[model samples]
Every structure is written in C-alpha cells, then in structure tokens.
Target: MTLAAKKKAFVELGKFLGQFASSGSAQKPDVLCNDPFFAGLENLIHTAQHHNGWYTPEQVFFAVQSWANALTPENLDQWLSRYDFAEKSPKTVALILAGNIPLVGFHDFLSVVISGHKALVKLSSNDQQLLPFLAKYLVAVAPKLNDFIEFTDGKLGHFDAVIATGSNNTARYFEYYFRDKPGIIRKNRNSVAVLTGKETREDLVRLGEDIFRYFGLGCRNVSKLFVPKGYDFKDFFEAMFAYGDIIHYEKYANNYDYNKAVFLMSRFNILDNGFLTIKEDTAYGSPISSVFYEYYDDLSDVTKRIETDRDQIQCIVSGVIDYSVPFGKTQQPELWDYADDVDTIKFLQEI
Candidate 1:
C-alpha cells in the first residue's frame, strides 16, 4: 500500500477509536469499517481483562483513547513531515512486543508501516488479541495493507531488522540472537519523579495519577520519588487519598497485602495509607502497591544521579523542572516523544 493509503487507513482507525473514549463511548457515522469493527472492538474492551487481567476496562479504554488521539491526520502528517520517504526501499521489520502494558509496542509497528516497511509481529501472549483485531480493521480499510502486516506463532520467517522490548534478562537473549541483524533491542526501564515541598495540593494529586495509572505496570509510570531532605509525608499522603478506591481491586489489593506483609516481615520502615505505601529506599523499580523514595540534599544532586543512571530511567517526572515530564502527563506521550530516546522513524528509514 502507498504511504498515503496507510496514513488514511490509520486516520480512519483513529476516528473509530475516538468513539471509545473513557469519558463516554459513542459511535460516529463517519468512521469506516465500523459495521464490522465497531461492535467487535466494544466487546473486546468489555472482555479485555479475560485475555489479560492487567487490561482492565478503564486502563484498556485509556490505552484505546490515547491511540485514538494519536492516529490523527494532523499528528501523522506533522510526525511524518520530518522524514523523506521518497524512493525508500521497503524492508520487513520484525517486532517482538512486550505485554506489560496495553499496546506497548504499537509505536514501533506504526513506525515500520508508515516508513514503507513490512512488519512481522510476534505478539506477547498476554496481549495477543487487540493489535491483531486492529490490524484486521486496517486491512479492511485498505486491502493492500494486508501485504504489509503479519503475525506469527512460530519463528520469524524473514526480516531485515528487529525492535524488541523485554525485561533486562530477556533482553540479553534478544541481543545475542539478533546480533547479526540491524535492530533496536529495548531493555526494562522505569520512570521516577522528583518532588519539592513547594508543590500544591493539586500538583500532588495529579502526581498520584502518574504513580497509580496502569497499576504501576507501565514503564512510564513513576515508581520512585526524589524528595528534599526535610520533605514531609503528611500532605503527600493526603493527596494520594484520591486513589484510595484502588485498594478495592482484587489483584492490586492482593499485591498490597503481600508486599506490605513482606516489608513488615523485613522490619523496614514504611508509611502506609491502606492503598499505597511510600518507603524511603534507593531503588528505581518498586512493587505494585508501593513506591520507593530517596532523600535528596539538593535538586542538582538528584539531576546528577539521574544523569548517572540514565539507562535505568524512562522518564523523569517533575513539576519544578522545565525539561521533566509534567505532573500527570508521563503516560500521555506525543507521537514524537520516542521511547529510549531512540528515533524509531529515523531507524526505519535508515534500515
């Protein structure tokens, strides 16, 4: 399919997805292929948790709405405008996706297709259904697109390059196997927030959204915090109260109970508010029901630490810093905010 055709198909997908926002889901008449895909997507959203328990309706809808907002004509045009696609030879780019969060590897897939390359996708078993169904919608919109996309249960048959995301352990295997191919191998990374005592109640509340979204499963979720030496937890705990209802969820509650018990058994110091715990530790990745925090003597010191451990960090959430991700905006990445600071489109163009 032509780039224009692929772009147009994705725009239609954006419109179809736009109908299923978390605010309210309402079908629109202008969306293409809705007669077949609309109800199918809705039913999938309702049953997504059966496929993956982490894919709750609210989180799944949030993921859907994020893609809905992203796959727009304006966004696509603006993002693609920077690259020269003329006379580019197409290659098959294999994608090994991670299922930690919904649609985590979509940007790579979109990058490969829009750059005039074919995709051989190996979906994580935890997130096997959604992307394939969406691929079906795209193929229905533009029949030729069927030639550009493939999903396989067995080994990848043929591919020029690869883009794989996995834990630090699995990443080693990917690096060893795909060493001969031009590929982007992604490893586990976590996001952290830096805080000052000066934050307002509203800022702190929005920061809670950054911490709790996706049950702290996504790479973009802030799992750790850096606070000033004398920072107090009273106000922070009060703000996090907004997410108290999270404890009612069985899986999260189980994690909370289990992790909390483990902490107590270790006799570690922690502050709990029924739903969440904030412990003063120097770790970047934290457990689901708890967030680790460390005391920073100065903002400069924290910046230095982040720069030192840059590979372990995905996003640096902060309200005080101009360069950091805003209070609650870590999960809502723009099309151009490439993960791992790697330009995916540029990678595809070169490959």
Candidate 2:
C-alpha cells in the first residue's frame, strides 16, 4: 500500500476511537467499519480492567482519545514530512511492547507499518486486547495492511530488526540478544518537574494530572519534584487535593496504605494528603502513590544536573526549564515526541 493509503487507514481508526471516551461512548455511522467494530471497542473499554486491573475504563478511554487526537491527517503529514520514505526496502521489525500503560507501544506498531515495513508484534501480556483489535480495524480499512501486521505469542523469530521496551535489567538482555541486528532497546526512564515556588494554583493542579494519571504507571508521569530550599508544602499539597478522589481506586489506595505504613515504620519524614505521599528523596523513580521531592539551591545547577543525567530521564515538566514539557502535557505526547528521545521512524528508515 502507498503511504497515503496507510495514513488514511490510521486516520479512520482515529475517528472510530474518537467516538468513545470515559464519560460515554457513541457510535458514529460515518466511521469506517463501525457496524462491526463500534460495539466491540465499547465493550473493550468497559471491561479492560478485567484483563488488567490497572486498565480502568477512564484510563483506557484517555488512551483511546489520545490516539484519536494524534492520528489526524495534518499531524501525520507534519510528522512524516521530516522523513524521506522513498527507495526503502521493507523489513520485518519485531516489537516487544511494554504494558505499563494502556496502548503504551502502539506508536512503535504504527511506526513500523507506516514506514512500509511489516510489524511482528509480541504484545505485552498485560496489554493483550487493544492492539490486536485495532489491527483488525486497520486491516478492515486497508486489506493490504493484513500482510504488514502480525502478532506472535511464542518466541519471536524471522525479524530483520527489533524494538524492545522493558526495565533496566531486561534492556541489557535485549542489547545482548539483538546485538547482531539493528535494534532499539529501551530501558526504564522517569519524568520529573522543577518547581520554582512561583507556580500558579492552576499550574500545580495540572501538574497533578502529570502525577496521578494512569495511576503513575507511565514513563511520562512525573515521579519527582525539584523545589527551592524550604519551599512550603501548604500550596503544593492543596493543589494535589484536587485529585483526592484518586484514592477511591482500590489498587491505588492499597499502595497508599502499604507505602505509608512502610514509611512510618522506617521513620521517614513524609507528608501525606490522605491519598498521595510526598517524601524528600534524591531518586527520580518513585513508587506508586508516592512522589519523591528534592530541594534545589540553584536552577542553573539543577539544569546542569538534569542535562548530565538525561539518559535516566524521559521528560522534565516545568514552565521555567528550557525544553521542559509544559505542566499537564507529559502524557499527551505528539507523534514527533519520540520516547526516550530516540526517533523510532528514523531508526526504522535507517534499518
């Protein structure tokens, strides 16, 4: 299929997804293959939690909406405009997806097929349902796409290139296993925010979305906060209170109870606002229901530190920091917002 054909298929898929949200789902008759896919997708959204406890309907809907916003013709064209897709031979690219969040690895799947290569996807067990369903939808829109997408349950083989996402340990295994082939091995990376004690209440509340969304499972979620020395917690805690209802989720509440107990037992000086906990720590990756914070003496020094440790960080959320993703926008990454600062499309084109 031509690039335009492939792009058009995804654009249709996006329109289908746009009909569903956490608030409710409505079938759009104009959406391609809606008669067959609309009800199935709505069911999937409602029951995703049964397959994976973290895949709440709200979270799944958010993921669906995010992809709906991204797969527009304008956005697709703008992103692909930077690349030359001509004169390239097709290869089978193996994708080892991560299930930390809903549809976490769809971008890689989209990248492989849209670049005129076949995708051999090994869906994360935690995320087994959504992509295959969408793959079916894509094939329905463009029958040729059937030849370009495959899902594997057993050991992956017969792939010319690879993209794998996992924790730091598994990344090493991938590096060694795929050493001979062209590959992109992604490791664990966390996002953080720098607060200068001048943030508006609205900024801080939006920052709560960066922290609590997906129950803080995504790499894009801000797990740490860098604040000026002796920064008051009064306003910060108040801003976080806006998301207090997050505690109603049993899994999150369990983490809060367990982590709070552990902290109390360890005599750690932690602050809690009923649902979330904030502790002063030097680490960037914090546990669920908890956010680590540190005091900074100088913004310049903090910037240099973040620059030096860029590999360990996925995103920095701040209005003041240069290149930082604005507050509340970490999860709504555009097509060009390559994960771990590695461009998947470029990697595929090169391979």
In terms of TM-score, how similar is model 2 to the real structure? 0.99
Tens digits of per-residue lDDT for model 1 on 1-351? 578888999998899899996677887888888888888988898898998988988999999999999999999999988888886678999999999888888899899888889999999999998999999998998888898999999988989999999999999999999999999999988999999999999989999999999999999999999999989999999999999989988999999999999999999999999999889898899999999999989888998999999999999888766469988898999999999899999888787
Candidate 1 residues lying further than 4 Å off, grouped into runs, are: none
Backbone clashes for every candidate come to 0, 0
TM-score of each: 0.98, 0.99
Give the top-scoring candidate (lDDT): 2
Looking at candidate 1, what is the lDDT of residue 134?
Answer: 91
Q: What does candidate 2's lDDT look like per residue over 276-320, in tens digits?
A: 999999999999999999999999989998999999999999989
List the global CA lDDT of all models. Answer: 0.91, 0.95
The pairs that clash in candidate 1 are none
